[model samples]
Target chain A: QQPVQSPQAVILREGEDAVINCSSSKALYSVHWYRQKHGEAPVFLMILLKGGEQKGHEKISASFNEKKQQSSLYLTASQLSYSGTYFCGTELIFGNEKLTFGTGTRLTIIP
Target chain B: DAGVTQSPTHLIKTRGQQVTLRCSPKSGHDTVSWYQQALGQGPQFIFQYYEEEERQRGNFPDRFSGHQFPNYSSELNVNALLLGDSALYLCASSRQQISGNTIYFGEGSWLTVV
Candidate 1:
């Protein structure tokens, strides 16, 4: 099943911070985060395993909670280049090699 | 270092027609996955190919098929295309089919079915 994302869309000032959340109904082995700009492919940001270790990529970071089957992405001091749609992909089992993606969260940054 | 590459960046097809999109995986990757992204939506996985065989598939119908060659190049074939099939087709590649491996994506092929 597709995961659910919160705050369908958000606009932030260039130096502000934003949080995007993803929740799954089923248990997940891992959560992957990606950002996609208009007219471009989704770019891999980071992946969080079920162990609850938070992963960070530049100003972006994410955390996964196995018990809640949820993950949250954090973008700090958002930059103009951070404007894009964020997606969370969940893997139900280890080595499944298939990801169920969320609807997506659109983030826009303004100067 | 080429990441992932896709062909026919954009195209148009008539309903009931067929279309084929191509992709080349990153230099050292051996797995290829296909996805469909409609407007304002996240990418939906179509399938994944490894060792020249389809190892995993998504919720798509049989009308969506794919083939992977020895060199890790792949092609997505859509039969009896419909207007609903109009979307951006993305190709992704990862190393060794690892679940947590970083997957690289191509710019995608935009198909507009009229």
Candidate 2:
């Protein structure tokens, strides 16, 4: 099943912060976050395993809550470079190589 | 190391025709998956292949098929395409693991079905 993302779109000024949430009904073993600029492929940001797992890349960080079947991506001190579509992919327990992605949240960071 | 690479950056096909898209996985990657992204939507998983055999698939119809070569490269073939088949086909590769590792995606092949 496709995950659900909140705040379909958002705009923020530089140095601001934003959070994107992804929730799935199925139990997730891992959650992957990625950002895609216009006309470009999605770039891997960070992967959050089950509970108690967190990963950060630069100003991007994410956490996975196994009990909630949800993940949240935190963008701290957002930069103009952060403007893009953010997607969260979830890995299910069935061991399928497929990663069901969320509808995506369009983020715009103004300079 | 080179990341995932896809071929035929853009393709145009008429309804009822067949089309094939290719992908080369990143170095040391042993698994390949295919996805379809409609305009303004996130990618939807099509299927995945490992060890030259299909291991898993999404809810996509059987018309969407794929193959993985010994080198870990893969191909997505769509038969009897419909106008709705027009979309960006993305190929992603990852390491086969029980934990489900992060998959790297290619730029994607834009297919237009007239």
**Residue A21 in model 1: lDDT:** 98
User: What does DockQ give for each predicted structure?
Assistant: 0.71, 0.74
What DockQ number belongs to candidate 1?
Answer: 0.71
Estimate every model's Cα lDDT from 0 to 1.
Answer: 0.92, 0.90
| 10 residues in a row with least lDDT, candidate 1 chain A | A91-100
Docking class of 1: medium
- Candidate 2 per-residue lDDT, tens place, A1-111, comes to 789998899999999999999999988888989999987888989877776487788888988888999999999999999999999998886355579899999999988
- Which portions of model 2 show Cα errors greater than 4 Å? B97-100
Q: Residue B86 in model 2: shift from native, Å?
A: 0.5
- lDDT string for model 2 (B17-42, tens) is 99999999999999999989998999
